[model samples]
Target: MKLLQIDSSITAPNSVSRVITAAVVERLRQTHPGLQVIERDIIGAALDHITPVNFPSSHPISALAGDAPEFAAGRATSDAILDEFLAADIVVIGAPMYNFGVPSQLKAWIDRVIVPGKTFSYGPEGVKGLIPGKRVIIAISRGNLYGSDQPTAALEHVETYLRSVFSFVGITNLQFIVAEGVQLGPDARQAALDKALQETSVLKAA
Candidate 1:
């Protein structure tokens, strides 16, 4: 089984999402022996925002002969990112809420994967997702509470956005392990982390 582990946290060792994701991956590895794992740290290798030069419409027909060096490089990077996502049977994402949304680095990665003809398509039936049957697990951390009953629930965008995007690409087997209110206090942080870690321990294996 192929597993793609994507980390988008800028906090590294101090990141709650990162710690939860690591525990989840380790659990999966234990359950699925010899699983092939590919790790990508978006914060470590930041991707540029999509531009006209690297956008799919601007891809050159042959060898990118007429394309600028930077443009060609950008296109290649985008293609590589998309290819990795396509090749994975399972994907585990470490996403922390940033200003009530996902980090720009993760969004940049999403831009490459959610291609029109590659991952999805539009038809008379409306829209159709090309990629299906892949399992996705997201580890999410939030500084404040945003549960359905919370006053800030409407401001919760990370999980909502991720669900929409993944479902759009035909991935319905989605799981989320969330740690919220980590910044509330030391006690609250540890409690949240403990709960999230417990969830990771019971994750279904590939």
Candidate 2:
């Protein structure tokens, strides 16, 4: 089995979510020794958004003319990114919430991987996910305690967006370990991290 560890945290060694995610990966490695792990840090090489400059091919159906060379240049990068994502048997995402949402790096990676006709198909019956039978785990860290029910719980757009988009690509078996209240204090941070670690333990057992 192959495991893709995608780290979207801007913080290198100090990232709380990254540390927890590494622990999760290590625990899984203890059980699945044969698992090959692939690591991708979006902070190092940010994904280019699909736009008029990057997604010229997508404009082929449009009446207006588009830049052929510019579109052709981005094809290789797009294809490589898609291939890496599709080849992974399991995907582990380390997402540290920025301003109550996902970091820009993570969103950029998502934009590249969840391409039409590659990750999903559009038919008369609507949309069908092409990449199915994959399990995904998202390690999320937040400053404040923002959950389904919390007084200061801000909008959980990061986790929700990930779930929705990955589900659209047929990844229904998604799990999340959120370490909230990290910025509250040292005690609160440790407590939240402990909870997240415990959840990771459960996930590993499964």
Candidate maximizing lDDT: 1
**Candidate 1: segments with Cα more than 4 A from true spot:** 56-66
TM-score of 2: 0.88
| Residue 103 displacement in candidate 1 (angstroms) | 0.4
- Candidate 2, residue 68: the lDDT equals 67
Show pairs that collide, candidate 2: 146-153
Put down candidate 1 lDDT per residue, 143-174, tens digits, no spaces.
99999999999999999999999999999899
**Clashing pairs in model 1, backbone N/Cα/C closer than 3 A:** none
Model 2 alpha-carbon miss at residue 10, Å: 1.0
Q: What does the lDDT come to for candidate 1?
A: 0.90
- Which lDDT values do the candidates have, in the order given? 0.90, 0.81
TM-score of each: 0.94, 0.88
